[model samples]
Target chain A: MRPLRRLVLAIPALWLFAFFLAPFALVAKISVSRPLVAQPPYEPVFSLADGWQGLWDKLSRLTLDAYALVFSDDLYLDAYLSSLRLAAIATLLTLLIGFPLAHAMTRAPRQWRTALVLLAIAPFWTSFLIRIYAWIMILKDEGLLNHALLSLGLIHAPLSIFATEAAVLIGIVYSYLPFMVLPLYTALEKQDPALLEAAADLGATPLRAFWRITCPLAWPGIFAGLLLVFIPAVGEFVIPDLLGGSDTLMIGRSLWNEFFENRDWPAASAVAIVLLAILIVPLVLHERQQVKERAA
Target chain B: MKRGLQPFHLAVLALGFGFLYVPIALLVLYSFNASRLVTVWGGFSTHWYEALLGNEALLASAFVSLRVALVSSVLATILGTMAAFALVRFGRFSGRTLFAGALYAPLVMPEVIIGLSLLLLFVGLGIDRGFWTIVAGHTTLGLCFVTVVVQARLATFDRSLEEAAMDLGATPLATFRAVTLPLIAPAMLAGCLLAFTLSLDDFVIASFTSGPGSTTLPMRIYAQVRLGVTPEVNAISTLLIGFVGFILLGAAAINRLRKPQGSG
Candidate 1:
């Protein structure tokens, strides 16, 4: 039993260490290395055959120029800022929309609640790229939205929504709405209705009861939903790339350009490292919160 | 206790569902349009769907995605089940915090960082980036999800059944195989399906990890979508949506079937 348990533990631990944790170390190492024109596109490459001394030599030769450049360049800075701003706005928008939807789901007839929840989650099972692509067909200049508006005489010309930040926001909110709604629904569904009834008995208005009782009870879900939406939205590549125009500067797109188009592995790694650094705290805190919740 | 959905709440639900479903409905509608221009309707036709059948590039990439999803989801399920057991059953162990962290981090880690980092690892190890590397990256990504699902099931699992089997003179292995496996089978199946869909739907990780010849369907779709929208793309997108919808419905039906038995 002891040996079997040990084996069970070791297999996944080793796999994650090799594939998940070790890669971060590699990214950190390559971030400080210089870009080369050769294959693999980075220099001061470490080889295991060279042993510790060679590793030490490679380590010593690693430069901070990539980091310096990431900090000094306005492109990287703007991309990072834009990503944060867009992600924050998107998160707020999802919460505004998701909260009411979740509330509605919980308020639904008891038998209908499960079906409603499933309906909310149905979009998530579809291919994310397809969902985003569906938006492109709707939001484009000559798309259905404009055609509908034009026929109604509400607008003289088509709205230029596609390839704009507005399009990206819509794409993000649409794609991730399920993520935000699920958590909020789960949290809301678990609440005791008696509390609201009790508040009403005490002469509390619906709005006041919602603020005092519902909002506080929904805090964990709100936090979880915010992190779920905002974190991924910040590094969202497809939504921004496909929906936002060339003027949209996102760190994820910039990172792709650096590695794929520019062939600058060091610079891309630097960008990744910085992005990771920014996100690690919230990620760790979220994980810790999850652990605590599970344990409790 | 008598409170029900108000008109305001009903309105929100209507708008919310509309926001979610309208685009999908439009995509399906446009796929049937005979027009070369996707937005313009030129009588209903199935020509685009027929065109999709002959597109070798799209079909090849889809085959690649299917193979990757099949293999990687299996790999993720195995690793994830083990990790879930370790976390839930093993309790306190050395490096348990780290183990939990590593297991859950991928859930929220940005895809770009995950992709870039894994690519660097493969390059550093002198391994060629291709189908297998995408499998590895996806397996890593998918396992975290599997762990979360399986862990939720494991947390709520009843251990007394296993203890009863052991008291009846069954070995621990036999008890686990007989009692635990059957009980958790639904959750495991759910985890595998989740992993499979995640791998199938992935674009970013697959993009960074794939080599010249290993383009997945999403990669292919992304490339074509970048150039311009086509009715053919809509046809394929509608097909994928339909396929995934079928799977989710089937899963839901299975869940409904299992619930009565569990409660009984």
Candidate 2:
């Protein structure tokens, strides 16, 4: 490339290197270091200020106690499992709800389709914190739902829905519904209707046609929506923090508590590394799929 | 081929929209509640909104968030636009894969990991955690969104105009300045708006990076909401929702206007 073009690429390239890629390297380094009680709260296992020999010496002496603790402890294991389970469940729920909504959008009048799409995605552009906060208001005991239920004489008392696992699930589904619907909508909308009509003309039932034609075509959308919701939902912090009960354990929340509440930077870094390892599998698979799709 | 709307589809649409919007509508409704109790509506009043105006800490944090969003979004847009140009125009280059990975990873990476990792990097470098640190963190996050937006626009871009400009003896830089910049300006603006909203809405990253006095509005909201729900928070959230909603609607309108007829 010419010098000007090289310069254009180098600026962002260098910025990402320094800010994005380098941070993970730091996290990996810190995860192997010892936690301390001093300022910054971690023993520096390797430092650039040290000479190559000294750096080699420190690196050789680095401890894996943080990772050991993360593995040996059931708390960390449960947190990881819980996070994965919750994310999986939320992804499934979102798909179930999103698929029909996306289908409905594709079937709507062409003039109304754009407006409907806008309505569906508009909430996402608003503050995420506010959206979750909105749930807190609605789900709390004596909140709107309970108030309405009681006024209608449906129940004798308010339901204690706030700060529960169910509430967290509700929050996740609500917050991530758009992420699920948009991709599914895109995928569903692109499919040729003639294929489905041809199936019906061949005497196949609507259900059979949907299963054979629609579902197969929507697989890409399903996969995309699943990852889009599952990946972030696994690492979600604010939703569970605000909506979940005290006993709720998520890897993201665990990492936050380890770093801020306990001030154990090394432990927190270890948890983060493990979480990244788990997420990398799906992310890499998704990348390979995208590359394959592009090539095709 | 037009399919008539079925009752099942109508029900699905109604229930789906209801699930998505009922909570927000309730929150907006209760923001004007006269009662201190959120659930019990005494009468329609704007007392909570008035109270928000007088809260000093909230106002201070709002100012901080606005400033951070402005600076970081602008920085993100410039760098992101350049990155988009590199990706679209420069077909193959050394480190292209790595560059693309780094740019797109932040979009899917969880905020906590990003926050924690960035904080550790700042601490490792002996840099103080404050306004600038938050800016750096947000700029990293925002630039990715900007890049995605601008990249989409660039992919479908018409290059004939630029070729024509070059054929007329306009230098590459001159052509870019006169033709390319104006054409992609809308996408860049959209990207900047997206970045601004991301920065403003961010809480976890700001909490991790902020020092003594650099609390953003989301951080402030999180702190208060954790203590307990209050009408004042409802008021602030309602205002933010309204502001962001207006901006998004405006963006959609602009996007619609920019499209060629019958294309959308």
Q: C-alpha displacement of A294 in model 2, angstroms?
A: 7.2
lDDT of 2 at B228: 80
Q: TM-scores, in order shown?
A: 0.97, 0.96
Q: Give the Å shift of residue B98 in candidate 1.
A: 0.8
What does candidate 1's lDDT look like per residue over B75-180, in tens digits? 9999999999999999799999999999878888889999999999998998998999999999998898899889999999888988899999999989988889
**Per-residue alpha-carbon lDDT of model 2 for A23-126, expressed as tens digits?**
99999999999998998788864567899888888877678999999999999999999999999998999999999999998988889999999899888778
Residue pairs whose backbone atoms clash in candidate 1: none
Shift of residue A42 alpha carbon in model 1, Å: 0.6
> Which parts of model 1 have CA positions greater than 4 angstroms off?
A51-56, B252-264
